[model samples]
Target: MWRRFTTVVGRVIPGAGSRCRKRGWVTPVTVVILGLSFLWTGTLADSNTPRQSVLRVLAWPGYADDDWVQAFEKRFHAKVEVTIVDSDEALWAQMHSAVPPPFDVLAANTAEIARYAQAGMLSPLDLTKIPNRRWQQPFFQRLSDIRGLVNAGHAYAIPFTWSSMGLIYDRKQFAVAPSSMRVMWDPRYRGKVLDFNSAQHNFSFAALALGYPDPFHLTPGQMRDVARELVNLRRNLLTYYTLPEEATALFVQHHAALMFGNYGTQQVEQLRKAGVDVGYVMPDEGALAWLDCWAITRNASNLDLAHQWLDYMQEPEIGKQLTQREGLANTMMPVPGGASDAGPKLVWLQLVENIGQREALWQRIESGDRLRTFPQ
Candidate 1:
């Protein structure tokens, strides 16, 4: 919910590396030889030769499409290599697989952006280069208002798309929309509920339902309590789903009455297209929302091109196309009946206190670990 490109070896300057290690500095004779090699190998090519810049993009499935990428390439006279990632774990693995990240730019949620920024994997953006950001809504334009985009007085990400994880209930089954997250736990919906198979969100939402002050940063006791709550939810769940398409199929097949809309409105739109009359709502405990943004890598090959790509995404028409095609809300415009619609509070995602702990415990809970084994 995310490219193949030939690796281009960077040209090494004669004394660039040696400058840091003076003891192994290149000799004058060696520098002269290297200079000639550059000329002989055509490293300094003719000025008239047309050169196309390559920009590798790592993004979610709907974020980078063939047609949209083609348009960006044509406009900038560059080549875009696209790679799609379906989950956060995979995205992190790919980003760290290489010494200098393989991609020039990537799209990631705010929490991931914070993690990458903290790890020094991302480059601070030059806002001046991205003129199109002015088109973004006020809520998005204020980088400080949104956590995880700025660090140490520098902004590292530009908002792209966002949505909330809410509840989706079968319209025919319920006369009115559910008002709280507790509805999923009601015995009436037991064996008829579908939940997304995600450790982080499951724990966060469970904390929310239990009325934790900060869902992202739970104490040791709170984590144990939340884990127990998830164990209870497991009993109510018809089954866990990894993808929206899979959830849609399970919902229709099992005649499921409720589902944790992990993909938010995107799932709603999909279910509707499949002829399912579903109603979505953010429970009284507030829904967890994600704001995905574009950020250039610290080792970006071409900063100008990367900035151009970010600016291009912020363009009104491109944003409109993204919303219309993917059913996601773009920062450039407000989408009616979108996650920001009236009545439901949205809790923007934040870097959690301990992701490893959440994943480990969630694995045990999801694998049928006994509730009695959990700490009281």
Candidate 2:
């Protein structure tokens, strides 16, 4: 067993959105989510051996809190080490790093899990080891129905959380909710818009605004069109933000008229807690949404422990806690009348046509490139 321990430190921001931040850490550290004290400290060189049966996890900021981690550790009689990541790019980098995969299990979106499984970095799950699947709602239990969870007669990921990226606007600014995503580019809201700084979602949102039938699978010609649209969007945006907290700060500081809320209701809860009355609208073309799942790593040192972690997360109480504490919807059961499910039409995320093309175009847009660079 790999016996390595590092300290993961973070600050206690005021609301739910505060957990999402651009992670800046010197070295890999494992945070023991005990009382879940949000402490901020610079990188510390504390080299100590972890106790036996360490189950390292890679998850989003709010996914692995103290309550769940502590309970999981107690139930499984293992030491839990969590690594918080802000973006799918971070998850990719950590898993594909030169070092052996540092995490035993990871929570990622359906698209990402597919990419990882394609790369042969994920392990086929032993369903018999995870008894909690029976307790999940039918939507989650039937992996065969979900497009990306099962591949070639093998289960690779377990459904966990799901939400969407909707158009969020200041209720005070608009007496009525903006009915279309095009409102963000209305020139009226120019310099008052905040957009997510993600290559995949940005491209898809632009396609949606352009009325493309398949936003995720844009043609090369459509790609160029989307790129041009994004450039126009860049001109309107005060700035691009990666994390929900940053978006919240920008919205309040700049008095932003609108934003593309990537975290869905979590962002709404955060903004409300921060004293902002915002309205979330699914644009006429529908909004981009995602289903995040948990998967065991191919390099997991303790495969059984990893399965136990998945089972623990599927428990109804744990799912409820996730919704209550983090404002995200879990798949353990249907979200019955909650902000998590109250949104515009959700266009579930699909595998993109070409991530490389999107990233290249996104870089140009971010660098202030002219629209003429796109294929005319």
What Cα-based lDDT does every candidate model obtain? 0.79, 0.77
Show the lowest summed lDDT stretch of 10 residues, model 2.
Answer: 22-31
> Model 1, residue 194: displacement in angstroms?
1.8
| Candidate 2 deviant stretches above 4 angstroms | 1-51, 335-344
Across 97-145, the per-residue lDDT of candidate 1 in tens digits comes to 7888788999999999999999999999999999998998877888876
Best by lDDT: 1
Top TM-score model: 2
Write the residue-wise lDDT of candidate 2 on 1-376 in tens digits: 2233445345333233333322220111112222222332556535683555878888886787876877777787787878776666667777776568888999989888888888888999999998888887776777877777888899999998887788888999997889888898898887888887678899998899899988999988999888988887766777766567766877887788898988888888788887999988778898888888999999999998999999888888888888887678888657433323334467777789888888888877776777786788
